[model samples]
Target: MKKRNKFFTKKNGFICAFLAPGILLFLVIYAYPLVNIFATSFCRWNYKNFQAPEFLGWGHLFDNYIKMFTLDANFKMALINTVKWVVLTMVIQIPFTLLVALVLAKKPRGWKFTRNMFIIPNIISTAAIGLIFLNIYNPSRGIITEICNKINPGSNVSVLADGNYAFWGVTFAFILFGGSSCLLLLTQIFSIDPGIYEAAKVDGASAWQIDRKIILPLMRPMIGTVSIMAANYGLLLYNEIALITGGGPDNATFSLSYYIYRTALGSTKLNFARGNTAGVIQFILGILLVGCINKAFRTDQGD
Candidate 1:
C-alpha cells in the first residue's frame, strides 16, 4: 500500500505538470471568452458605449434575449437558417460521408485513387473553395450559365443573385465535400479485426450482413464524432456566405455567425450586447447538439 501510494503520488505530479499548460490555455482562450460573452449578453455594450459594458438592471437582465426573439427580424432569420443548415449536415453530409466510407472500405479497384480524389476538396482551403464556387455561380463566365444556355437556348441562370438559389448554391459549395469525415469513418471501419470478418464469412455472413451488423454498429462513436464536427461547421458557417452571397438578395442567407459579425463588428451601428447574446444562444445550442448526438450514438458504450 505504501509503495502504491508513493507511485501514484509521483505519477500525479507528472500528470499535473502535463495538464497545467492545457488547462491554463483553455481558461485564457475558451473559458474566459465564453464567460465574458454570457455576462455581456445581459449588458448594453455598443458603439455608443464602447468603453465598457453597462449591465442591465436585474429586472431587465433578459432584455437583450427578449429583443432578439421579439424585435429582431434578422436574428430570427439567422437562427432559422442556422437550424436548417444543422439539419442538412445531419441528413445529407453524415449519410453521404458514411456511404463513401463504406464503399471505399470494400477496397474496390482504384479505391485508393478514388479516396484521394474525394479528399482533395477537403484538403483545399475553405476560402479558396468559396471563391471557386462563387465563380461557378457567376452569370457571364460560369459553367452553370453556359450549361443552362445550352439546354434552354439563351437562358441566363444566375445562381447567387437570387435568394433561394443563393442558399442552395452556398449549400452545394460545402455540403458534398465530406472527405475528411469520410476518412475518419474509413479509419474506424478498417480498425475492426480481420479475424472477425473471416469468422463471419465462414458462418455464411454476406458482405451486406457484415457491414450492417458489425461495421455499422462499431462505427457509431466515430459517426457521432464526425457528426458533431459537421453539425458545428454548418451551425457556424460564415465564410461561404461572406464570399458568395454576403447575406444578399434582401438578407436571405443570414446565419448566426454572420449575424453576430454584422451586429457586433461589420455594421456601422454595432450592437455588441446583442451579438454577445446571440453568441450565448449559439454556445448553448452547440452544447445541446453535442449532448443529443452523444445520446443517439451511445458513444459511451464503445469498446
Candidate 2:
C-alpha cells in the first residue's frame, strides 16, 4: 500500500501541482457559475426577489423553461434568430472564409496585403464595425441611400426600418468579418509539408486535384475547429447586434445573448430567473451545436 501510494505520488504529484491553479480557477470561474446558473434557473427570481431566490419545487421546476418557449415571444424569436445565425455562419461564412484562405495559400500577388486588409475589420472592435455598418445603412446620409436614389431618383429604403431588411442588415454587418477564420485556415494550409505538394506535382496532380484530394482532406480537422468557433460566435452574437440594431423594428433582430441581457438587466422588469434559464439553454445549445458539427466533420482513420 505504501509502494502504491509512493508510486502515484512520484508519478502524478508534480503534474497535479502544476494543474492545481488552473483547476481551482476553473472551479471558481466556470464550473461554479454554470452550476449556480442551472440551479437558480429553477427558482422564481426577479428584481423584487433579487436578494432571495425561491425554489419552484420539484413538480414546477421546469416552469421557467416552459414559460420561455410557450409564453415569451421575444425568447421564441431570439431562439429562431440564433439558430438562423448559426446555420448561416456554418454554411456561408465558413465556406467563404475557406475559399479566401485557399486563394491566399496560392500566394497570389498582393495576397499579403489582401489578407491583412481582411483581418483589419476583425482587429477593430465589433462596436466600431457595427457603427460603420449603421452609417452605411443609414437612409438619410448613407451611401446605400445615395445608390438607391441614383438608380431611381428619389427612392427611400430604410434597411433597419423593416424586419426582414433589418435582419439581413445585421447579418451582413458581421458575416463577412471572418478574417480570423481565414487566418486560421491559412495557417493550417501553410503547416502542411511542402514536400507533399512537390510529390503531388511530380505525379502530375493538378492544383485542383491536389487541393481537392490532399490539401482539403488534410485540412478537415482544422476546418472542423474553425467551424466550431464560427458557429459559437454566431450563436452568441450580441455586441454587433446590440450596437447596430438594438433589437430594433420591434425586436426583429434579437439574439439569445441579447435576450438574456434584456431579461436580466436591459428592461424595467428584471427577471433573473428567466435570464439565467435562457443562459442555461444557450449553454446546452452551444454544446449540442459543437457536437453536431464535430459529428458532421469527423475524420475517419480508416481513410
Candidate 3:
C-alpha cells in the first residue's frame, strides 16, 4: 500500500508540473484582474481613491447592472447589438469559416497559395482593418462609394456612418480574422476520420448529406467553441467599432467593453467604481458563458 501510494504521488506531482505554467499564467493574466475587478466593483472609487478603496457592498455593482437593464440608453443599444453580433457570427461567420475550411481541405486550384492569401486579413491588426473599412465605407470618392456609384449613378452608401449599417459593419469586421493561426479548428475538422467520409460516399451520400449528417455533428465541439469565441469577442468588442463608429451616430453601437472605457474615461469619468463594475460583470459573464459552452461540448463529445 505504501509503495502504491508513493508511485501515485509521484505521478500526480509530474502531472501538476506539466500544468504549472498554464495555472500560473491564468493566475497572473486572468485571475488577479478578476479578483481586483470584483473587489473594485463593490466600492466607491475615484481617480485618486487607489490608496483606500472604499467598500460599497455590491450596491455599485447592482446599481450599475440595474442601470444597464433599465436606465442606460447606451447599454440597451449595446445589448441589442451584442445579440445581433452573436447570432450573425454563429449563423454566418462560423459556417462561412467552415466552408472556407472545406474548400481548403479539398486540393482545389491554387490551394496552397489561396490558403495563405485567404487568412492575410488576420495578419493585419484590427485597428488597421478598422481604418481600411472606414475608408471603404467613406461616402465620397472612396473605394466602396466609387464602385457603387459606377453600378448605380450617385449611389452613396456610407455603411459605418449610419446607425443600422454600423451594427452590421462592426459585427462583420473580424469575420476574416483568425487567432494568428490557420485555425486550430480547421485542423481539427480536417483531422476527422476520412474513413467515415469514404464510407458515407460508398453509401451514395451527397456532399450536402455528408456535411449535414457527419461533419456538423462531429464538428459540434469545435463549433461550440467558435460560437462562444464569437460571442465573447463581440461582447468585449471595441477598436473597430470605436474607429468605425466611436459609439456611433447616436450611441447605437456601444458594446459592454467600449462602454466600460467610456464610463471610465468620458464625462462620467468620476464613476470609477461603476466602470469597474462593468468590467467585473463582463468578466463574470465571459467565464460563465465559456464554461457552459465548453461543458456542453464535453458532454456532447462524451455521448
Each prediction's total of clashing residue pairs, residues at least 3 apart in sequence or on different chains, is 0, 0, 0
List the candidates' TM-scores in order.
0.89, 0.90, 0.79
Q: Which order, best to worst by lDDT?
A: 2, 1, 3
Q: On residues 1-303, what C-alpha lDDT tens digit does candidate 1 reach at each position?
A: 897778778679999999999999999999999999999999999999999999999999999999999999999989998999999999999999999999999999998898889899988888999899889999987788899999998878889888888888889999999988998899998898888788898999999998988889888999999999999999899999998888876788899999999999899999999999999999899989989988998776336
Clashes of 2: 0
Give RMSD to native, each candidate: 3.8, 3.3, 4.6
Model 1 scores worst on lDDT over the 10 consecutive residues at: 294-303
lDDT by residue (tens digit), candidate 3, 123-196 = 77879998887777777645766777789887677776778887777766776564423365567667899998
Query: What local lDDT score does residue 82 receive in model 3, on the 0 to 100 scale?
Result: 66
Q: In model 1, which residue pairs have backbone atoms overlapping below 3 Å?
A: none
Give one digit per residue, the lDDT tens place, for model 2 in 103-123.
999999999999999999889
Cα TM-score of candidate 1: 0.89
lDDT for position 194 in model 3: 91
2 against 3, candidate with superior lDDT: 2
Q: What is the lDDT of residue 299 in candidate 3?
A: 33
